[model samples]
Target: MEELLKTLNNIRSLRLLAKEIPLEQLETILKKFELVVQERKEEEEAQQLVLAAHQEKIEKYKELLKSEGISPEELLEVMNLHRFNPSQHKKRAPRPAKYKYTDLDGSQKTWTGQGRTPKAIQIQLDKGVTLESFEI
Candidate 1:
């Protein structure tokens, strides 16, 4: 973010400089920006060609599978039976317990730290001590 801010300031300085400088120097700077735009356009065209080639190759593979008597659904069933499932292997995020108050018998009282504050905790807030004071 800082680097981008510096670059934006530099461009503003250059724009101001163009007003006081000779026409030839300003035209040169303009031409450089135009060259960068042209280069990006050429790169985009090349990428589109590569993407089309990959799509064509994938279509060819699909035809080959169909000719050999396999449909997409059959392939999916085979893959599902043995595939590495990211979701199945994932561990759920551990929820940190928030206990902010207790009853007269000393049972632990809890909160999930979202939505409207619980009444017991609200009573503490009304008395002027914060929820952090009772956090376990």
Candidate 2:
């Protein structure tokens, strides 16, 4: 890997290696490199086409906004007003416990009944006990 990296990084090393390689093997390597280059060029051209399409749409929107007597800056300000502000939003408070039960180790535990049932509660539930029996 290191030798490959050194050869790639140094033009002199690359030229020397290329000169030593058999013509047939060199032709095969060249063909593969050319294919890779063509693929990359096609990918770049596709991306450029997408960017051009986006630009065209943006221009059309700008013209529509102008016809409606609204400047881009004004539209941006209105959009910003409705945009979410994490600092201004408060996190919701945690839900209160809905059920209380004794664990297998004889310790009291509480659950909000939101997610998976506790193993201790599940064991009793499997034995025909009602889930409501553990209600807080």
Candidate 3:
């Protein structure tokens, strides 16, 4: 992530260096971003492939269940929680838990994460600290 940010900053600096960055330079940066996007798309495609394979296994299991006279719904109930996105496994962290609060003065507010201020704090962030106190 830091490397990506550095690359972005370097690209911005390069753009600023030119009196007017040429279309070719812009295209180059666009191409880099496009490559990243393409990679993500491919990841999603691979996830779909895994999902298909899992579904195929489930179908085979269904056939076995049929042999035992099990109802389709019963089989589905047994496997309901196994349906998960393969793409999600390699992606960003899960969203933080959210909480809504009303202050003593009757103010309404909501925050995310496990902290005093609910901005969806990351694990590395200081726990239970309000946003104002976070700077320290």
Candidate 4:
């Protein structure tokens, strides 16, 4: 009962708020909302057509497999048997030393060729030093 009362109050509040809004502004807002709804409907229809076409293609392929005595379950089992390890799907980190160069003090600096340039490398770069000069 309390929930129903709260919902009724919310509706009344919205109606009062709507009455306060200018008629011309409300009409314009409604037109824009209607346009959005129309566009959404069109997009959904296009997607439905695309989904139907793909479903048709899938049915044809299934029929072809049936004619060849191959079931979808068998195909799935064969694929599952040769599935790659989970670790193989992970992205590998770049090696820390793709390029190495010596500073004026004879200390070494290395870059992985990723992310921001280190201060040591940036100074050389600002001087127009070629990146190839630092190649490993």
Candidate 5:
């Protein structure tokens, strides 16, 4: 009974010690987290700058087209169709299992190419295939 009481007391003491975290350590951890957030924010800002540059280039292209007697409507159509946005497209399609294809090493390798049915990928789709098949 005395040994059990001592064990309980030791456990309680350990719990008390565990709760006593240093402010400096916490501040350091918080500082690291803040740094990560700042880095991510900077990366996003840089991406915005790149997109702005792309817009500027498109404007320049529009100007060039205008000089060549092309109408603004034609330029708008081209820009609308060709504008790139990374987030707008799906990265990959859902897969039930990884398709293992033979690599250079003669070993079974997972499919690196994007698509649903790997074997059914057609370079030029027939009229039967919808335009939606080309998306993402």
Candidate 6:
């Protein structure tokens, strides 16, 4: 691709510098360019046909749903209810607490010891208290 682009650039520079290209060579280049344009047009038309077919199928399904008294919104809601959304997974049961302590406010609290150290535990630890001392 890079070499093709370089060749094209060289041809462009030559065209700019030359007084005229020979008629036969110019005709040959024009024919190749026209073939490329025709191929592109055919590919575009094929894509349009595929898109039109897909749209037609969608419209037909919509009409069928309407005939059966189901609105598009209802269909979408039903689909969402059955969809396997990652966030909708059943939550794991809470981990059992591993430590118990009393807060500054005199309320009991427990920790699974998986997250940040609780303020009550932190204060005791700051005073050289061992974490195992609070384990349940």
On lDDT, who's better, 1 or 5? 1
> Per-residue lDDT tens digits of candidate 2, residues 1-136?
9989998789999899989999999899989989999999999999999999999999999999999999999999999999999989999999999999999999999999999999999999999999999998
| Alpha-carbon deviation at 33 in model 3, angstroms | 2.0
All candidates: TM-score = 0.48, 0.59, 0.37, 0.51, 0.39, 0.53
lDDT of 3 by residue, 2-118 (tens): 875775679666556554767888789779989999999999999999999999998998889899999999867878758885865787786553655454456765555453543
Q: Cα miss at 65, model 2 (Å)?
A: 0.5
* CA-only RMSD, every prediction: 10.1, 5.5, 19.0, 8.8, 20.8, 7.1
Per-model C-alpha lDDT, please? Answer: 0.82, 0.96, 0.68, 0.86, 0.66, 0.91
Question: Compared with the true structure, what per-residue lDDT tens digits does model 6 show for residues 11-127?
Answer: 676575344777788788889989999999999999999999999999999999999999999989999999899897899999999999999899999999998999989999999
After superposing candidate 2 on the true structure, give the runs of residues whose Cα lies further than 4 Å from its correct spot.
1-6, 91-136
Q: Candidate order by TM-score, highest to lowest?
A: 2, 6, 4, 1, 5, 3
lDDT, candidate 6, at 16: 56
Question: What is the lDDT, from 0 to 100, of the residue 118 in candidate 6?
Answer: 93
lDDT of 5 at 57: 99
- Which candidate ranks first by TM-score, i.e. highest? 2
Q: Which lDDT tens digits does candidate 5 get at residues 39-131?
A: 999999999999999999989988898899999898679888888877798778655433444444456545434555433333223336643
Cα lDDT of candidate 5 equals 0.66
lDDT of 1 by residue, 13-92 (tens): 66666678899987897799799989999999999999999999999989999999999899989999898888779797
Clashing pairs in 5: none
**Superposed model 4: Cα runs more than 4 Å off:** 1-11, 86-136
* lDDT by residue for model 4 (1-75), tens: 987566446978657767888999878988997999999999999999999999999999999999999999999
Assess the local accuracy of residue 42 in candidate 6 as a C-alpha lDDT between 0 and 100.
100
Runs with alpha carbons beyond 4 Å of true place in candidate 1: 1-18, 86-136
Candidate number that wins on lDDT, 1 or 3: 1
- How good is model 6 by TM-score? 0.53
- Which 10-residue window in model 5 sums to the lowest lDDT? 118-127
